[model samples]
Target: MIEFDHVSKHYPGGNEALTNLSLEIRHGELLVLAGHSGAGKSTLLKLIAALEAPTAGRVLVNGLDVGRMRRSQVPYLRRSLGLVMQEHRLLMDRTVFDNVMLPLTISSQPPSDAAKRVRVALERVGLAEFENAMPITLSGGEQQRVAIARAIVNRPSILIADEPTAHLDPAYAREIAALFRSFHAAGVTLILATHDDTLYSPYGARRVELAHGKLLS
Candidate 1:
């Protein structure tokens, strides 16, 4: 479970990205953060990931206070989350398999085990045949699939996507949305931040709308 209690995020130069935001995301729920740009959707996601600290109030994940965790504890917290950002953030120089193997490599998992997990992740994202391919050589949608595979390679309990389909065509966008649904159905908690309401509305996920740093719905 994730909870935000009177959370507010203020950036440098006194810019407030979120304001007294309070909400709870239960495990296994598919929650969509929908709003126009600058609605604090990304900030909210970051808070949950512990990538950013709240300026006020508290953010908790599974009863652990994110803002209070020690630096050494951050990695363990992140290991439980699979994050997919708007940017692919791939190592353009690396093979798709290598990119997907990164998280396991950082954790120092055994090579054989990492390889098996990497293959399973690639297969889940329909990129099994492209493992040896370079991310730079793939199409936009395919590259996004590689990113998704990389995110899930560790088999995280929660998946957070930030505008994952922003750069894709309609067909590719739908494909990515279906991919998320499959993960959700398999019991991975999902929190997706996107401005494209049409893409997620049909799935009937709970919608949390934000406007000017505050919850609008």
Candidate 2:
């Protein structure tokens, strides 16, 4: 479980990205953070990922406080969380298999084990056939799938996605949502930050809606 205790983000320019926010997310829940641009959805995700620290309050994951964790422990904390971005930040020069294998490589896993895990991840994302293909060879949706595969390949307990389906068509967007549902069913806690109404309105999942940095509903 994750808890947000009066979290807030204040910038050097005096802008407040998040304002005394507090919420709780149960494990194995598909929680969607719905909001417009600059509505603090991304800010919330960054805090959860520990990419940015909260100016006030605390973020706790499974009873561990993120802000108090030592610098050396930050990477290990992050390794337990899967983060997916809107852009596929794939190394265009590398094959899909290699891209999915990057995390295991960074963690010092043996090449043989990494290869086995990468293949399973690619197959799960329905990109097993494109394992040898470069990022440029795949469609935008396909590349996004590769990104999702990479995020889950590490078997993180929590998954956070920021605007993951922004570049896809309606059909592909729905497909991605379905894929998230599948992951959620498999017991991974999922949090998605997005502005797409098609994803939230008539919403099927638990949601925290924000507007202008304030919780709206």
Candidate 3:
């Protein structure tokens, strides 16, 4: 449900981040964006997530032009998508339950409903019993799972992960990859950006390679 047509992104100082990159990510498909650092992988993800507007051309989600959408509609677009980052961007002071509750709470869902959703999300990420646990007490793998739980807690239609397995050991990295697969199986449109060949090579997903801001395709 994501489309990029002749899209290009140029920073204020004129560094090109994407160059006429055209791609289509189908609904329920697991697409992997693979490349080295500074290869525009993250830039592409940010554009799809609606976190950054392209300098030229278009980015569409479900046929809605992301760059042309009203600023007020951003929250609505974002709420429909789940984003997992390389770093675990959890609130240091909050419990895992509260962190997962943030999305539902921000969307103004009732407390009772948010609690139920949080429980399900944690369970999906294999973190059900860690609800009351502090984020600081968790291992890197656990923290990453918590991040994933927080992302999908809202049941988003699209899930984007940027280097989701960066910090973990090989075992945990595989664990996180499997979790992504599980989400894909459940029909969440998935896009993951990574430099790890082992993770993407074996998956047989549609692969897009980027180098110096251009799709090598």
TM-score of model 3 (CA atoms): 0.97
Ranking by TM-score: 1, 3, 2
Using TM-score as the measure, the top candidate is 1
Decoy 1 TM-score against native: 0.98
Where does model 1 exceed 4 Å of error? none
Q: Candidate 1, which ten residues in sequence have the lowest lDDT sum?
A: 195-204
Q: Report the lDDT tens digits of candidate 2 across residue range 1-217.
A: 9999998888789989999888999988888888789999988998887888899999998998887778898898888888899887999999999899988988898898889999998988899999999999998889999999999999998999999999899898988887877888899999999777456435457878998777887
Model 3, C-alpha of 24: deviation from truth (Å): 0.6
Whole-structure CA lDDT of model 2: 0.88
Give the higher-lDDT candidate: 2 or 3.
3
Worst 10 residues of 3 by lDDT: 197-206
- The better candidate by TM-score, 1 or 3, is 1
**Which residue ranges in model 2 land beyond 4 Å of their true spot?**
200-204
lDDT of 1 by residue, 1-217 (tens): 9999999999999888999999999999999999889989999999998999999999999999999899899999998899999998999999999999999999899999999999999999999999999999999999999999999999999999999999999999999999999999899999999988677778868999999899998
- Backbone clashes, each candidate: 0, 0, 0
Best by lDDT: 1
